[model samples]
Target: MKRDRDLVARVLAAKRDPRCADDLVRDYLPFIKAETAKFMGRSPQQGRDDELGIAMFAFHEAVLSYDRARGAFLAFASMSMRHRLLDFARRERRHADVISLDERRPDGGEGDERALVETIASERDELDERQMREASRQEIAQFAAELESFGLTFLDVSENCPKQQRTLEACQRVLDCARKNPELLDRLLQTKKLPMAELARGAGVERKTIERHRRYLVAVLLAFTNGFEIIRGHLRRIVPAGGDGR
Candidate 1:
């Protein structure tokens, strides 16, 4: 537990100081390889495999985007690497639009004399969709687990969410304030409590209102700050593009 906190602190510091990025990556190479190897079902060799390079980049990204609220840094980096490798595999599987008409058949028979495009089906889409659904399920499960630390759950967040448009807008404003103010977010994560007074002041919303929608606001803000891309993508409809708090 202490080690995880220390690592997260180092990652946060590295994000502010560009010079530390390389050292950070170097120190975590073994971890990166472990994550990549787990996803690939084999160990990746440095400077010899493309997957290692992708995992390194993903780890760097995780460093930049990680928030302690999202749980352990290693877990976050592992998920990032997994998703990146999956994406790479999908790209590699993509077939060319046109193939030789006289290409030999897979059955070692005579030439088909037909474009490979004709034999292609919608299997790719279905496969991609299945992968996406599985990824989403994993993300939600991780999110729910993190929410447990705050004495909240997915059900709590859903049930506590503001019902009215005006109330929802108020909660969104609070979330916007947290997103723009790193100090506010840091305080929330550090204390495991929301800074209602600071949030109300920064968001220009009433303190009582902020208190009322505290759980919902925390859930939304955590999604944005924690680099939960899947969860955040689903929240686009509720929260506007910019941090205007509208």
Candidate 2:
């Protein structure tokens, strides 16, 4: 509820605000870590700590160049962190020569061979993790597609609010209204596959109204999903596993 001053504004105003900057890091570091780990495929032995460190480095880079005029902090951080992790993964692979199936173990003993087999197994596990990450990404892609069909934009309605409190309140109101309206709700769900005009016709509303509602809806969903898990809970009931909000 209390948005520790707008980090972007604070950064621009003073050219620095320790508190605001720290708050921004606190708000986004976990997200950066989670997303980066998902993209990089965490190793059971290596753990996520290395990836977390890389993400933090990426976050710091983002903070230096963050432009409020461009986009939300989360969107910027997600893209920045994703690129950082990918680059890090590339560098790591370049440094370490991945062993082949027919390669001999350095120690040349039965015990060494077993250890090598374990290492190869770990590599395979990494591939499996990559597959899972790819699947989740595809799902998110589908989720975005479903949302677009409804003719709503991921527009920033909150940009108009100078104050964070107002922005949060606006998000709440949008969520509340949409949740209470079955026609709008149905349209939102079906939008996963249908076109915006089609969704508007189904909802019996003008295309502009649907567009407006979309910006508001995204704000609330982002807010709820960020801290409360409320949106995910609603999605669970509304969308089945491997199914969009149909």
User: All candidates' TM-scores?
Assistant: 0.78, 0.40
- Candidate 1 residues 98-152, lDDT tens each? 3453453353457534435544446567767777877777678778877888999
lDDT score, residue 99, model 1?
A: 43
Q: Could you give candidate 2's per-residue lDDT for residues 1-246 as a string of tens digits?
A: 024235445545433765666666676666766776666566322244677777776776677765432234454556566666666765675455354445656556656654454466567568647754664464356345434544444444434332455443443444444434434443433333213464454435555544544555453343322221223555444222221221
Cα RMSD (Å) between model 1 and the true structure? 4.2
TM-score of 2: 0.40
Runs of candidate 2 exceeding 4 Å displacement? 1-7, 10-20, 40-48, 98-150, 153-246
Give the whole-model CA lDDT for all candidates, comma-separated. Answer: 0.78, 0.49
Q: After superposition, how far is residue 172 of candidate 1 from its true place, in Å?
A: 1.1
Top candidate (TM-score): 1
Between which residue pairs do clashes occur in model 2?
146-192
lDDT of 2: 0.49
